[model samples]
Target: MNLPKRNSEDGRYYLMTPDAREKLQPLFDRCIRDAIDGKITRPDSLYPPVVVSSEGAPFGVHYLAMDWAEAQRAETFNVEQAVAFSENLRRLSRWGEIDHYLLGVLERELQKKYFVVTGREDDHRWNREYSLKPGIRAEDVPEPLLRFACYVAVSYKVYGLDFQYLDTNYLLGLVEKVRPNMVKKLKENGTGRLPLNLQKRKKEHFTASANDAFAVIRISAKDCTEECYSEVLNYLCELLSQEDFPRSYAVEFKGPEKKYLSITGLPKKGINQLCACAVQYPSLQSLLERYARLAMRQYERYTNLDDEQCALPGSFAVFALGMLGQPWRQLVWDYLGLCDDEHSRLQEKFLREYVKQFGFTADTVPIFVRGVLSMQSMKYSKDYAAWMANAESLGALLDAKARLSEIVPSGFSSDDDDEDDEPTDETEAGPEEVLQYAWETVCYVIWGKASAKRGLKVVETAPEELKERYRQIFE
Candidate 1:
């Protein structure tokens, strides 16, 4: 559909309705007054471009990106150069002696081109391309002059100003005074208007459903010292007391301390669990994800960066997969109260469907299965030799299973422990070990000690051949 074009004479978005014309007349007069005072001699000075489009009318303004020629001319030292320089200075974060030199250049140019009289009044109306004028051809106007006009047009479009007649000298002075202070004012007030043509797309991915909300909780040692198991457990207890969740969640660690930090709650319980989770998992992956999303949003808001350089992490897909495979899986089981038989059947079904969807080789299946098992077994700390051998063995087993059409048995289930089962060792595992085990399992359903007094759960269904291969490497 062809959208109505904005009029270039006034900064509004529609063709000149009678009411709009009435509003614009005074602004045009003012612009002419300013132009005369600033000694702008061209007849075009009395007919400055409009900044908006009226119904059935053409757009009032347009923009070109800052070019090299414009940038160079903005640096000149003369009256006109000074005006252009001052305008640029107003936009810069930091301007110094060089900026002052250019401002002087613009002032001189304005005096030469314009006729400055204290109270002379001039008025006219013309229709042409918003940026062009009869006597003031594009070739005759320096790049700095064009750039300055463009900036004025842009400001008018954003702020709804009448530019047909402006006090150019007064504006020049205002630019000079505010140039150094613009940054401070922006930080303090944040009142600048955005360009009128800018359109923001509504966020489409987020759902208002409570289940869609996720929280990341972070836990840390009260002091920066190494965390103890007791302290971590105490913190977790305290957090649980503060937050109620409809479902379980996952946590992760960040930084060298490995002190428990952040927790991410599933959708239903996010609001209730977030703060407490933060207390337990200080370096929570959910917190990281939130920050990452924010950074990505900021990057998208500004079109200055390329896809590769955007703040979104490269490992996001892998991290998401881990979340789905492990903690999310556990949450489903716990929430649905799946029995051992049901859980095993579901796992087999899932594997078969996944293999079919991906057209994966049988050899690839064992390797993938082993990786999943290792993730579930909390064996990430195993040495390189052990990891490699386990992988190779798993690959071979997957091949055998594929060829035989054998369904692998369920490996480890977290709910299998008997109430009477107890650990033989009395000494508590180090805080690092406890936290690491907890964190990994939360990421990938790895089996580990449920508590200091509980023994570890070994994954049962990953296959004997793969287990033997891992043992040989470790031994």
Candidate 2:
């Protein structure tokens, strides 16, 4: 945490009815339209919410992270708009006259790619010399952040109430507009990565882009006063910081003055008695994870969790509005009560829903099964193997799949078919052969079709062999 509050690493938000959204949309549009119509649009257009706050709500209710006005302006920003904004700032700064180098620096700053540097683990994000409230253990937030974050946030509470927020959604539209150009420049810049220099006091393994930007500003704006160049650089740094993309954003709830949700800590998972702030709010925290995970998979090149753990996180990325999280997954969180070991209970509630939502696809079912097994449970792990060993028909019989009936000698049914209570032998294959082929097809997909085909003949005939072999995948 810097001495003067830096806006980028910190964030803000609002929660209002659909009605409030309508009022805010037009005011934002009004600002842009006015700008195009020759009135200057400043970043502070939405400042002092009374100027632009939605009617019938608390004044100054607008989320203040990027400032509501800045956020609104970004929505319709084009690459051309980004250029104009930079040029406009330059003209106002009189920087070209002061230093031609700064003209280039300012231009280059516009085209920047930022990365997050999550420092130490085990630091509390928020505490009042706060003892760890008994909850699930989580990665720690840095102590400096916890103590200093109040100056960072809290005062801007919408209606004096803390509003939940998104990580990148609060991002400036201008940043998104310049993204393509930023990538090109990043390549031209040839690795912004510097050799490891240990930051001693903070214990942070890495430094933020804000720090990097300030250094550049000091050198580039040597002619300007400390106040002038520093202020400009700080503002620019805040914008660049927004581009940083939070490493691991989370949600925390505590009813207090600066103590409840430790605004000071790194915005990772929940800390202290929060029970690992990651899971409590499915709608919110998971969305942040999905966003961060997506950034890693598509934009960045680092990862903390293993490939197997990436199952859920990797599902949907690079899909804008059209993407959705796996609904069955959200259900799994709800089903996990105090402990995670209730595999049978969860399978009934969780996996059963999955089968319903997704009919037996050879690949997804196997992959999904593995993701479920990733849940940390000795019982789930041990019991899953035993369950599969005893299971007949790859557990298809346990699904919403058509049931076996004496009336229809064709014992199997399309699990995909909802209306058909029992399967008819539509294809030439017999019921036993159909189930066998289904199981084999599933096995083939998991081990990859190119391999694992040779064992099919022996396994198909021997139930015990098939069960043990299937159980091995879990092991």
Q: TM-score for all predictions?
A: 0.21, 0.22
**Candidates' lDDT values, in order?**
0.28, 0.27
Candidate 1 displacement at residue 99 in angstroms = 17
lDDT digits (tens) for residues 267-334 of candidate 1: 22222122233334444544433422322210011111122211111112122322234433322222
**Lowest-scoring 10 consecutive residues by lDDT in candidate 2?**
151-160
lDDT of 2 by residue, 370-407 (tens): 32332332122222322333344355423312221211
How many residue pairs collide in each prediction?
83, 7
Q: Pick by TM-score: which candidate is best?
A: 2
RMSD of 2: 24.5
Model 1 CA RMSD to the hidden true structure, in angstroms: 25.5
Q: Itemize residue pairs with steric clashes in candidate 2.
A: 122-140, 123-141, 125-265, 145-264, 146-264, 270-277, 413-423
Which regions of candidate 1 fall more than 4 Å away from where they truly are? 1-181, 190-294, 297-385, 391-475
How high a TM-score does candidate 1 get? 0.21
